[model samples]
Target: MADSQRTSEPINIVHQDEIWKAHVKLEKDSAEVWPRKWGFLTDIYKEYKMESVKMKETLKVGLPSHEVVPSLTTLQKHNHVGPSPPVPQTTQALIGWRSGHAHLQLEKYSTVHHGRRSFLKELGWPFDACY
Candidate 1:
């Protein structure tokens, strides 16, 4: 019994020693890794702050100030000589040149796809037969 207890005590002590070593190794690794991660994050944050400041400075220098730019009423008075032309009430005028181009494209698509379907109709086939 004395010999058996002595053998079992050494095994338990070795197991406890292994668990203590693992705990210490984990603490040391955590201590080593976190500082490097925090340092890298700090550097990135500093760079971002510097870039933001540079962008703000560039914007401040590039954009015209309120005092330098002419107001809307001042521009209107200078541009118009006498009476202004009447504004058109049509939707085409409101949409401008893009509307004319869109209308022409629609007409072309209809002529190609819908207007030329008579051949398929005469042959007793579906309109999408070619497709």
Candidate 2:
């Protein structure tokens, strides 16, 4: 593949329930099926299969942006993917870049730790999510 990449139009993610279902259904083997790319989210949702088996694996990637992570309420506003019940206030603030966008535990991912790695450098984001 060529090194050049394109950004495509920003995804105004509506239909939260449908989109979330697709994300949750992304299996462990999806990395192979999807193949990692500059736009990581694109690597998901192609040729999705129904899995009768439950998955225990966690697929976490670092945050993506030349922008910063939205605030909890901001995420709620922008993402439109509200929780079934109210989320804890404690986890609210952490619901920004790494935790929200990357879909990982706070400890498992960090802009300071992972984002600065050379491969991720080009995916620029604001300093707010930095450690």
Candidate 3:
């Protein structure tokens, strides 16, 4: 493949935090004050949409290898997210685990997996509405 044919795609080089952080402040305050629990599900759906965009960006760039936290490379797996190994004494490892779980959840609930047969039967969502 020649370099000339390469498309000028804007790769997201920053981390997921940066991506989500940049646009989070622009959201309007929730107005569903009554019931409190009333429509929190809708708000969650909105959040999922935003995170979905960022995740897609991260996916496009591909996860980078980190020297400071070498094991972070493990999170790049498509089906990542499981219990961390025993003896997680460092904060970095915990943070990595959280990040991996969050990413996996986004995918589990994304429109990309909206309707096909799934092994994750417990996570089944209504086929009519989704992120």
Candidate 4:
């Protein structure tokens, strides 16, 4: 091939060493800044814990300790019902709605991961077209 059209050669050992050194320096700099960058998250977590404690105290005062929380079986007994009529139109409509919502969520995820389809497929997504 002509020199102008030739592909570039791989980096030499000296150049690779320099690149490694630069990467190490960059990593060290980032490590130094990482704590400062994420320090607010720690503060926020502390505030959240304090607020949760205050809420728990408020709840304890407002609600009776004898109140019985509903069991899952009780809730399921009240909520579970017989299967719906096997109406083709209604089934298709519900599937469409669910697929549309799933697609929208996948679009948002794709902006970050750029592998939403493969990720969903790996998770064994039921609706192939949604991803």
Q: Give the candidate number with the greatest TM-score.
A: 4
Which wins on lDDT, candidate 3 or candidate 4?
4
Clashing pairs in 1: none
- Cα lDDT listed for each candidate: 0.73, 0.52, 0.62, 0.71
How many clashes in each structure?
0, 0, 0, 0
What tens digits encode model 4's per-residue C-alpha lDDT throughout 12-53? Answer: 789879999999999999989988999899899999999999
On the 0 to 100 scale, the lDDT of residue 97 in model 1 is 36
Sorted on lDDT, best first, the list reads 1, 4, 3, 2
**Residue 90, candidate 4: C-alpha displacement in angstroms:** 26
For candidate 4, give the lDDT of residue 59: 80
Q: Which stretches of candidate 4 lie over 4 Å from their true place?
A: 1-11, 61-131
Question: Model 3 over residues 16-107: C-alpha lDDT tens digits?
Answer: 56877666644423443543757778898999999999989888865466644545565576445466445457887766564355444545
- TM, every model: 0.24, 0.13, 0.19, 0.36
Q: Model 1, range 64-129, lDDT digits (tens) per residue?
A: 676588889999987644433445688667654343454334354455544554888999998899
Candidate 2 per-residue lDDT, tens place, 1-131, comes to: 33235456554457767788788678645765664544555434442322212221343445568566667987676665434434547865645534553444446445554444542355576555566
Better of 2 and 4 by TM-score: 4
Model 1: weakest 10-residue lDDT segment is 97-106
